[model samples]
Target chain A: MKLSLGPLLYFWERDVVQSFYQSISKSPVDIVYLGEAVCSKRRNLKLDDWLIIADMLDAAGKEVVLTSLALFEAESELGLLKRICGNGRYPVEANDMAAVSLLEDQSPFIVGPHINTYNPSTLALLSESGARRWVMPVELGGETLKQLQQARPDNIETEVFVYGRLPLAFSARCYTARAQNLPKDHCQFCCASYPDGLLLKTRDARSFLTLNGIQTQSASIYNLIYQVPELVSLGVDVLRISPQSEGTLETIDAFYHAMHSEVNGNRKPIEDWQIVDYEFCNGYWYGQEGMLWKRTDEYKNLESALNR
Target chain B: MAITPVGMKRITPELVCPAGSLPALKSAVENGADCVYIGFRDGTNARNFPGLNFSTDEARQAVDYAHDANAKLFLALNTYPKPDQWQAGVRAIDLAAQLKVDALIVADPGLMRYASQNYPELRLHLSVQGSATNHLALDYYKRHFNIQRAVLPRVLSLSQVRRVALEAPVEIEVFGFGSLCIMVEGRCALSSYVTGKSPNASGVCSPAEAVRWEKQGDHLCSRLNGVLIDEFSEHEQAGYPTLCKGRYRVNDSVYYALEEPTSLNVLEILPELMQIGVSAIKVEGRQRSPAYVAGVTRTLRSAIDACINNPEEYQVQPSWMRDLDKVAEGQCHTLGAYHRPWQ
Candidate 1:
């Protein structure tokens, strides 16, 4: 299975973002998506900057995709979506039906996770419209993926979220701005401070979620490294790793090593391979609760097969 | 034996009102509401806030009282459940069914399946949390899951509503007042990502505890989870802290990335809605005071009578309908998705 680096969901300095992609272009990740998929107001990097990075990654022998914002409030945003559709250099990931309507028969676009592909018929309709690839939401796993993939149109690429916090929702309301005591129209870009995202806890203080602009995410960094073998068995075309502020490169390298090796040293098993120090949970991928993880001998064998 | 001559009866659309408290329930029934929707105070329901919803004893008594007064009672079991809470939610649904709720408004398919299998006799209405904006999702619920009604999402236009009502077998309950959610309900992930508790899974969104009203020299700041969304001076009106209507700063300027604070005013369009085949008119706020419920229901009930009676003058916004400030969001109102041209 190939690895695809998801777009940067957080706001970083422009130089920081560019440098992050510089390293990504050289990494083992086969496909790299570019653009801001969240709040449209996050403008640390514009479309040109994303295009520059996309060109660099494409030169580095990687496929690049431009993603549209999940929520659009005005005509200007729609105009930009039209412009992105006409960019021609790369495919656009349509997150909303409006974008899908725009891409019908015009180009081979990607049906994004937010596009609501819960069943076979919806998948068939989108694929017939022009979807060459599709990404299952983080909540869906191997079992659900197989169902969608079975009814998938001929040659539809299937990718799944394998790492990083799961994006739960997008809205016009900015929770961070609200937390900062400002309305969404006058928000001061306060979300820029936390490069990763602010942790949200239950009143009892359980770390349960994270806030990034208008988008909400799972507190746990979903890691599916152990399920790579299951992924291979299912013939998933790509594994997506969402961008994180720190240690993402290390995580990428660990995935690379595991993807190419049956065992790390001492035959300790590839499933036992610790990719970064983040807490690992494969429950969603395994059709268990998202918070559950299984580390057994079988899981070890599964990991070994994935890495090899 | 009593035998009566058949009398012509004009069918009045059922007015569904929200009862945040017991007193509100009594006031709603007293003010001629055909039905009332409520929930247990826990996270089992969508309006799962502290000091809101109802206790078990209160819910049972409320049901009895509403039935005694010739009104129906609905229990909202709309929030999505985590794996751990699924059993508890099922228990709650079963209990409500046993209490003889007129119907249960639920969103999750798995939970709906549970209700269908375990308590087949219970009435089920798809909650707005189901986000059945398109017909197919609603058709799935009606044909296979056996939902009797569906509360349509707020993102649809009137023509879309007509199409949906015409196609689906279930009755359609629409929002007539309160906060207008800009995003598609149940399908939204924004609140859960920021606050941990989701409107879908946990039954809360842009929760009040996470909100802060910070006052600067002249402007009052409203923040949710420490993210600044809006600022108002002493001159501007204060609205609730909801994520979608908040503002954001991009580049050097701040803009309204979502929607502005506004109440949904479909009162003027009631005749159009009815003409389009809406089965029921639902007022959205169940969290407001009892007085607000009485006022809204009284005005709307009068308006519905006039519309079905005389259609000409009813086409205009009512002179008394403007008195809806006590129950509106942002102290202002709009036609919402019906007026997407303004959006």
Candidate 2:
């Protein structure tokens, strides 16, 4: 399975974003998704800036895809979506139906994870509407994906979000600004301070969620590194790794090594698991509570045999 | 209802209300609801709460009662179904079509395709859970499923709503009152992240089973699955522990980081909504009591009538406002995204 880099879901400085992609040019990831998928007010990287980065990544033998915002509220946002769809070079990942509508019958595109493709017929509709690849919604489990694979249209690739904090929701109200006692219009670029999003804890001080501008993400980082074998066996064509503020290159290397190791018949269990600075969760894939981390086989085998 | 004056014309928008049970459906129709939307008890709809919604028998009777009262009945099969549950959604659609309900409010494109292909004559209204905020999104549904109407998500500004209505190929429905969803419906996974259930996958948010309330040092702490959602002081009133309405520490201060516990009341915008060609005004709260549904339906009914009869003299009466406020969440209301400052 090929590894793809998802669009940046957080606001970052233009230079920081530029250097991040500059480092990614030498990474093993095959497809790179560019552009902002969260709040549209984050204009640190305009369409022109994204195109410049796309050219840099393209020259490095990486496929590039532009991503549209998850929530479309203004005419200006829709106008931006039109420009991205008509960019002529890279295929756009349609995050919302508005994007899908604009790209319909034009050329093949990628359906972003935000679009609900829960069943086969929806997948079929999208495939018929010129979608060449579809990212499974993050909330769906492995069993659901397995079932969808039976009826998935031919030549359409299935991608899954295998890493990073799961994007839980998007709203018109900016939670980051609201946390600072400011309205959305007066957010004052407060989200730029949170390179990986602001952590939210319960009254008992248990980490629960992350608040980035308009997007709310899971506090527990989603890691399916241990399940790469199962995902590959289930006919998944692409594994998407969302970008984080730190250790993204290491995270991508870990996943890339796991994919190759499994194929080379010398599978190395993921040890030294401090790849990112968050607790790991794979419950959504296990069809359990999304925050719970079910034990992987390596840990299960190390425990009592009866525990299995 | 339509009112014609000389060369000018105005179509009184439909007063669509929610009914989670047979009693709620009856109360809404009795209280002047032009149309009532309901869900089956089988977890196929967004309001899939335990002990709520209509059984097959209950749904058949609901259709008869609404037809008898000259009020329309719309069945809500709005949630996206997984592969195992896909057949259940199709069965619910078949049952609703067989009962001859006025329309089917749906979100999933697969289900919409199935319903349109199998039951060719049934009317389909795109549910708010469809999250069609722009004209292009609405056109996607209209072109594919031949939907008759589309409920706009609550995320749109008033001018955006007007612009969409002008360019929309289908009739537009806007939320007039209900518990405010800070996030767009069908797209939010906060519930699933915390409690393993979501409106898109399981048709519930902040499910009741995951909720627990405790009194700690004179403050009431509401927890969902051992994660505290909010803590209310002795004098402060506590609303439902929806994650968005919960207090969280942001930038070193605790506050309702997403939204305060409140209901969206658009009675003041009824005239503006009608002028912008809004075909229906929906009163949310299927999980609420029959009395709540009746009060909201009656108040919005009167508000729409006044706005239609005399647009120049239309004023939100204090009595109507008080009646709605009594049933509002957090006992507060806002114009929500209809007003620019709230966004």
Candidate 3:
């Protein structure tokens, strides 16, 4: 299985983004998804800047794919999509149907997680339309992925979002701006302050969600590091690690080691890779609440015990 | 209000309303609905609430009753199905076709392909869960599955709705009145992030099983799976525990950072919608009571007729607005994304 770095879903300084990719170029990640997948107003890294980084990553023997925005409401956003699709060099991850419509039959592209490819028929149709690989919708459990893998066409690759905060929803209104009592049109780039995202807490003071402009994300980081062997056995082709503002390289290293150990048949448990101020959740993979972490082995043991 | 010329021709858009049960279907059709949309008592549709949808037998009866009243019956199989549950969705589609409903409102591409392949003559309307906001996305579904109509998500402004309606290859439908969803449909997973179920995956949002209501001091707090969604003071009324409409702490202050628990009312823009060639108007409350369905259907029917018959004098009646507000989410209504100021 190959490790792919998912696109940056947060706003960061241009220099910080450039340096982050510079370090990733030398990392163990085989494929890197670049470009903005959130608000279009996040212009710290323009298309040209992303292309420069893509070239640098390509020179470092890394495959690069560009990602489009998840929610678009303007003609200018569509114009940007056209330019991204017409880049003529790298594969584009179609996050919305508009991106898929633009990239269909033009070149081989990736179906991003937000495109709603949940079953075999959708997979077949997309594969016919020149999709090389399709990311699993984030909300689907592992049982669903297993069934899809069994029925997926041989030509299409399957990628799963295995790390980082799960992007839960997108809206026309910007919550980060709303948090500061600002409208979306004049957001003042407030999202740049919280490089990860503005954490949303419940009235009981429990961390619940992350507000990143128009995108709402999970407060708990989705950690499928322990399920690498299970994913490989299920024929998952790529495991995607979404980039964060900090400690992304360490997260990539942990996943790389886990996958390598599984392949070598000398598996070692991942240790000392926990980032401060982040909670881990693997429940969505187990068909449980997404914010709850359920150990697969423990769950199986409990199930058998209950049967007895 | 401007009055229409006496000799002018007016094209009235179809008034589509939701029906959660046989009685609701009959009430909606009897009241004034030109079409009634429903889902089976299963997870195949987005309104998979318990005790809220029709059984297969009930659906068959609904078809006959709606057809008898010259009302079209649309079966909604709009949720995205996983491979394990794919056959159940297919069975629902077959049942819908066997019942000879007017159309199938669907979201999943896989189900759309299956329906078009097996039931070629059955008309297909893209569900709002399909989230086709632009013409190109509509064209994608039209080219692939030959969809006859597409419902626009509530995220678009009135101008954007007009642009798509003018350019889309298929007929267009817009939300007329109902509970407002702040997030884009189908794409939102906020419910599943806290709970295990989602509208796209499980055909429900903020599942009732996970919801808990408790009184803390003088406030009533609503929690979903132990996560506090909102708290209301004694003077304030409590709404459903949808994650988007919840109050949360974003920075230093606590408020309804995403949206207030209000409903969407578009009666004031009926003229703009009609002028833009919108083919139908949808009322979104299959989980609502039969009385709610009847009242809303009747009010929208009268408003639509008044607009069509006397376009120049198409004033929004205060009574109509008040009737809609009484059944609205927060006892209040906004234009939602249709008005530019809200966005």
Top candidate (DockQ): 2
Quote model 3's TM-score: 0.95
- Candidate 3 runs further than 4 Å off: A274-277, A295-308, B1-11
Tens-digit lDDT string for candidate 3 (A23-81): 99999999999999989999988899999999999999999999999887777888999
The parts of candidate 2 lying over 4 Å away from their true place are A297-308, B1-10
Give candidate 1's whole-model lDDT. 0.74
List model 2 lDDT by residue over A115-160, tens digit each. 9999999999999999999999999889999999988999799999
Give the clashing pairs for model 2.
none
Is candidate 1 or 2 superior in TM-score?
2
How well is each residue in A84-164 modelled by candidate 1, as lDDT tens digits? 889988999987655776777889999887755645545666677788998885655576677767667786888888889
True contacts kept of 3: 0.76
**Candidate 1 TM-score for chain A:** 0.90
DockQ of 2: 0.73
Lowest lDDT block of 10, candidate 1 chain B: B1-10
